[model samples]
Target: MRKLKIGYIPMFRGTARGDREILERISKELTDLSRTMDFDLKIGSEIVFGYDTAVKAVAEMNSFDPDFTFLGSYGATIGSAMIPMDKLKGLIGLWAVPEWELTGRLPLNAFCGSMINAGMLAKFHTEKHIPFKWFYGYTDDPLFIDRFKVTFQALKAIVALQESRIGLIGPVVDGFDYMLVRESSIYDLYGATVDRHHSVEEVIKRAKDQSEAAVKDELAAILAEGSKTCMVDDEAMNRFARLSLALSDLARDNGLNAISMSCWTNIEFNYGNAPCSAISRLNNKGIIAGCEADIDGAIGMIISRAMADADAATMCDLVSVDRADDSLNIWHCGPAAGCLANKCGVKWDHHFDMGHYEGDEWHGYGVVADLTFKPGDITLSRISTEAKELTAFGATMFDKESYQGCSGWIKDYRMGGKPMTLAELLSVIYNNRVDHHMSFAYGNFESSLIEFANWKGISVAKNTGYVDHMELGTLGK
Candidate 1:
């Protein structure tokens, strides 16, 4: 992952009697933090006092081309704050430090300065629409650090999205119209490119070309990890290994950050094996992969991985909503990363739905990783078909038994900081027409995802109950 670049300009009123000692201490602490954290911090050489100084400071920071900038209020004049707020290009941070002592004319009116800055920016930037976040307390304060880290993580995720290059291998599966997305809209909104597209036949040819000697190590590794194998034969396992290697090479050669493939009936019919286990292996290797040629779903997985800074995220469907246990079943045809397997461990098996299709040769033709997801906190998110809205929620996956093929049961759902019942969640999904596929990872990234959505000017669907009225004009309001 790339480290975020952050620029900091400390401001103070020239005439105010401010404590230089405190300002120096804050600077040192921030410098130390930059060394330890995942961002590269560039602090201003001297504090800005007046409009001219503020302008020069802003120019210097702008030259840095930071993803985010911070206007640190040492005891700043309103003009100083406005200068950077107006000129800075991306998300801004208004940082205000509390006074060490209350007596004797207040050493530094930092809080008041920042409050005025916030109000001024809110009014002036409403039209310009510059986004900014508020930060209060000393540099070493725990709460301040927490908010700062979240902001940093959110900014990093945004960068990840903008720089991502996704490969669409084959079109959305037949009849899955909701999985379609406009490539132009995706580039316009997220700055991610989906220019690379390959037919299912092209990938199949690549897989067939792989020699037995080439896939020996990969097959060995896959078999070594599985506690047991069922239904799937040696031919199916070898095909999976070849497909995995082929996908890896394609991603590396094309400089692709993620991939979405039509890994269903098409691949199964053409190649005699589903790409589930291969997709799982790619995800475990940090190449984000989504099945059914769901470009938006792949993007959702990219967002989850970026926010969690984790290598793998699972793309699954909400198969069942059990009111009895207040839990929802999250399952897929087995493309989940091996790291998510429960204590029962990963096993090799045929796809659960393979029997539905015709042909005796197709029996045990689907190679999939069969395992239940380990118990942990999870974050579920999906990008709407139009790429204009995002739905995200957090839940806890229970330790109870789950069905095979990358499955789990999650309860205790929460969205927008409020507890949500399974019934309400189901209503939200159905009424909103959310995509059947949601990408998730084992962590609480709801807040980071919300921040990312806000930064991108994408509307986040509310967690409230279903609404019947259209209200055309007030769509995003």
Candidate 2:
């Protein structure tokens, strides 16, 4: 179980009727939930002191370094000083339901609306460049608990994967912010580091130092393996092969495990056009590399690599990712053996740049492992911003046999679950919410993911298979 750093503030909890006594009652209730759920509750009240609870809350919020922070009832209504908002990883607001007795003396909805204020906190998070989620409702509600636990666990995995370092060489295409996640959020939450990001000039400078003989030697092995080598012609192949050598050497020297490189420079440098076929070769080394130098998609490669380390899984773009459970079709152009564990005929795993359309240098090499768990429970995961961190965790998968990617059924198949399927899990991941993500690991890790979730204060849940919307659609008609 991962030890959770949960944020909570003391001071006041309920309406100011024997305030300390009311707070004590609420604390006891929260304690009960913690004990029952086996969560490590890090309360703000214990850390925050004196006349202002808001100041105390923010202080506690920073100190606890929580995966998620639960703003107790009163803390919301009478906020003291402002929280940096950047400091928080994620947010959860607890609203005490209004009973006749509880509301008669205090404005129930007004305070509940304050719980809504946490949404504003999320807004502030957005503007201030913080990644967070505003989770609200009665803490004891089973629905809330169920979703909350699952979310926290998933959030943890997302953040952890983000903390991962993906070396970016050269430039990415324009207007591609999705590939570049916020640097601060990852650093704050998951200890994610970007390491060294280089440009084409750097690669060229490195390439110049390498002897042509060494470059030729590397290309010899690559050429021997690729039939595409003959089809691509020599002019294009020479430049890419040299680039591949430089990249491999740089990766080894810098201790980089993964990379995303832009292949357009060959044309820009007047060296003829070459797809980033080099990325395919890197993928064979089990080092993930993306074409177009897209960093956003590189995170997916990160997810796949992490999954491969733990389970029988693969990483792929949503295009090749089929939502149907029976067969999640993952394919790559270069490596025949990259997607399969055991294969025949020379058993060669090679890389080549796909995404080519007749004459373009933007092609990429992709590697996909079949990321479906058949028969029993399998966890799906990705590293995304969670409570301002890059966390990773398991997610629900659709049934094994009923899936296929032939049609656009990925989205269709994803629509019907209670955040249990791959689609449902990703549906709510938004600006204020966490990223849509999952980590599918083999076996029933409900216990482990949840145990680690609670210990780390991450969200956790049992994996329910995908919902069958077609059946529901038929019923609706």
* Residues 1-477 of candidate 1: C-alpha lDDT, one tens digit per residue: 678888888888755565577667877888888888857888877577767777788888877888888788868576545855588656789898888777877778888888777877878667877778888887668657878877776887778888999999988899998778998888888888995568888888888898878899888888777843657778888899999999998899899989999877789988889899999889888899999999999988988988887768979998986778888999999899998888878898888776554565544565898989988899999987374888899999888777768899999999987889876787667656678999998888788888888878888877676446643322334
lDDT of 2 by residue, 1-477 (tens): 244456665434355445455456667776777776555777654522223546546766676666667654443253333354345555444444333245465533434545444554555445654333344445666645665666555544444464466677766655544455565654554455655468767776666577779878866876564434224445455565676677788788877766766654432343333433455556655666655565544554454444233422333333234434523332233211123222211112112433344466433322112112233334433343433223233433333332211111122122123234444433323212333323233333343333333433444322233354432221222
Model 1 whole-model lDDT (C-alpha atoms) = 0.82
Best by lDDT: 1
Q: Compute the lDDT for candidate 2.
A: 0.46
Q: Give residue 189's lDDT in candidate 2 (0 to 100).
A: 43
| Candidate-wise lDDT, in order | 0.82, 0.46
TM-scores for candidates 1 onward, in order: 0.93, 0.47
